[model samples]
Target: MVIGPDGCGFDMRSPSEMEADDARREADEAAHAPRMAVTSRIRRVAQPPDGYLPLSLFDEVRLADPVPLYAFEDVPADVTGLAVDYLSRVARGVPARDAFRVPLAGARLVGRSADAERLLAMVDGFSDRSVRAACLLCGFDAASRRGPARWRAGRVIDPGPATVYNVRRMVARTLRFMDRVGPVVWEGFTFDGGYTDRVTSGDGDLLTADGLWDLKVSRWPPNPTYTLQLLVYWRLGLHSTHPEYLRVRRLGLYNARSDTMWSVPAARIGADAVRAVERDVIGYADGL
Candidate 1:
């Protein structure tokens, strides 16, 4: 299900059709709407009297859509903490570290988001094996097979999709998933229209600055790459699909099992990290 050539869905045909369709769509979109980047910077009009939206109103938008493609893993607060610890170790370059003996209990959320209840619910349903699964989904063979328990030396990890892999293809799915996060619902902030989901722009849940939060459940070593993934989703509002929708002032990672969490400004995490990952992924596709 590749979107049109330019990463917009109006052109729903296959890759071959993308080039010409993209041209036409770009022209039409150009005349009708501004570039996503520019449009996003313009900011959406503040809604409601106080420049804020209520929790229940946001629920209606959540209900409008039949399915949410972006994954919201329901993992325990404790397990998330463990992931954080494990990440710290990996980042420190303790190649031989093992995660099996580490217990998952102390993971605490450092910040909160608008979808707090739903996010917590999702984490409740999440499994510790998710990272491994992501590797598999990317079409690679991985062996270290890390879990909530231990790490291994000489573990053959999958680098993920090769060059020649379709950039437009792989990223579109990821981008669309990134696009659906609701507007910032924390009462103090407001949004512009650049954001939208399958239903409508500004339709989903809004996390007031207080509402935006993330939980990490770990099994393997820490990865700067992993942290950056979180930053990218937060900082750019997953590509700045809408204005002020994800104005994240406070973001953090919780280590559930250990009752530990680290909160930081989105900028402190370094914006280029995710872009670097994106670049590598694209390079993989090119090699393919």
Candidate 2:
């Protein structure tokens, strides 16, 4: 069940209460918008450490990529999630099972929102039980779905106990990869801060002293959209929040499946390219 802000129990708001809550949240956000913008501007003017570019160049930048698997991997992973659904069909060469079972493998590979959070906590020296708890939660969530069995894309199939065992193995591999990478300043950091007033806000999987890294659980190198995502995070971090904490020199994508890392200097993401990304993203959002 969905938890509420107080965490005393599950969310149980009535329709009217939910609407009122939404309205209040919007109002509070509107009230804070000006202050946030001013803070962002002040941060931009501050000089970065040696070898780092100023944040001003990215103020007008926007992301051009669509909300596909490669582009939005920072979102919670699920078996039936967009990324897993695509991977199951194209990469895994496995016929799709019911929607509920689709996310079992992908969630283990990439992780769901709770899984990411728990992993971050684990890296911070929290108990290993957090990882096990996350795995169990995912499995429980999958098994709890109450719907008639349905085929995916006209493919009829069933995921058996072996599938569950495979998910556990994948989780162990993922955890091992994280251990190799070591600790970071932040993980699963969403630059948005739950406010959508500006274009800079987005997700950055990990933040380090030198750069922002996006974790990829894919076999291939990250695509252009993934590169663009790092650029966006760098831009957002530069202009907003603790600028000193975000004085990153580069952007990186870590391929967890391959245990490989790829990075480039942040300065190489030119203004012209950012402008193009901005145009495309704005245009797409407008169309939507």
Candidate 3:
């Protein structure tokens, strides 16, 4: 018998049908290719609002502060280091909770040393690599003790009894110095409110109605770099759209260890200096 079109062994499609199937597949691929191109273009154009400014651009900019410089003479190395660390915390407005969270070897040394001399001898004998660590531990320990009796009162978390009394003793002296200096409004004042994207941010230890103050807990005297740092802050403030920007009319540094404060007139940090810094920053950014 002759095979019918619906027979089980028959070829279902003709050559024309096969050609039409190939044409449809090619058309589908062509239709999708444009979509893929458009998607790629969108991705290429998408970018952050601030665009791509290198970090170096922000670093290159320097500002000026009119504050006078101070010289610290004949301060003990250990005392200076301790004072710098303590005052730096205070200046940054670091909460007692946060400061106490920092791990210190002094915490372990607590109740371990029988006397000050023994503790000193132990610390003195520490390897060069361990000396800084020991000092930091001692500083933290002393600060923790003094926190309860002073400004950080009720904030000191008990790491344990004091094993190093001398560290606490040194901390007490530093606290007294802080107390004698009296209170300033800008302690821990941060200038991040108006920071533009891709720009550097800064903070001052103290902010007054008329000026901004940076705290330096250092044995060394103020230098141009410090002044420039303050100057940059001033420029950032001046350029800021924030209402409080105008309030910062002065710049200065407070040497916590030396108990000295130096303030410069805001006017002294001129537009020229700001422009110069901006130029340098832009040049650097371009190079990158």
Candidate 4:
């Protein structure tokens, strides 16, 4: 529930918050920027003995190369990730009211406009707010509320048929991954507790009965940075006062674009590598 700067200290504040304390936030970011360089550290130090895509336990859950339900045109991966994540919640029966309340509230402040109404009508009801949230998360203001693809001339352009098709297709694949993994215990949660500081804090994607999972929409397989990110999340989870993370026995990546899943047991990651990241990159407190 605590929203702030992401792992690299990128300010995720609402537009209003940015305007209100821009100067102070910039100063703080400058002061802590060095410690926020966790991604660079991961590239340098985070290596697993078996490599990024270690043998998966779920080898039986085969997925074909992603085929678009509609004709495919390229879309931003970030936007696609957000849409699929939101739709996952809806598929799992999360009430529309429960998702994207933060960004939706921001949207409300922007007030109902013709574009907003048009957008709401465009999506299946469950995911309407999610599309709005994606817009803001991607970069929205009072000006660009309909999101990147659908915004034009200060108006909400109707989503092209193909865009909607691709989003639904991707969401279906994510649901397939979830069904294979097991029921989700948590989604869009941060490893909230003292282990995280302003610099090393981030929200993780999903946790199921099987393991902790991150949803990636990238076409490529898990890279060193992505693998290290998962490891760091696990360490933070263990260090956090939150007890639910103790249930995590594996770290996983589900690539929505490729429709493939990669996972490794916590024990498979090199202990020395993890320790090095804890001390050097994440900068966890002594004795944590």
Candidate 4 lDDT by residue in tens digits, 144-238: 33333433333333345565566667788999888888778988767666343423546678988759988887766666678767877787778
User: Taking the tens digit of each residue's C-alpha lDDT, what string does model 3 give over 55-147?
Assistant: 122212112222322332232343334434443453346543233232233333443233323423433322332233334344434433333
1 or 4: which has the higher lDDT? Answer: 4
Order of the predicted models by lDDT, top scorer first: 4, 3, 2, 1
lDDT of 1 by residue, 199-249 (tens): 012111123343343333343322443343333334335444454444556
Off by over 4 Å in 2: 1-183, 192-202, 278-288
lDDT of 2 by residue, 200-259 (tens): 233345666566766665545555455555655555555445553356776676653354
Best by TM-score: 4
- Best prediction by lDDT: 4
| Cα lDDT computed for each candidate against the true fold | 0.31, 0.42, 0.42, 0.61
lDDT of 2 at 105: 39
TM-score, ranked from best to worst: 4, 2, 3, 1
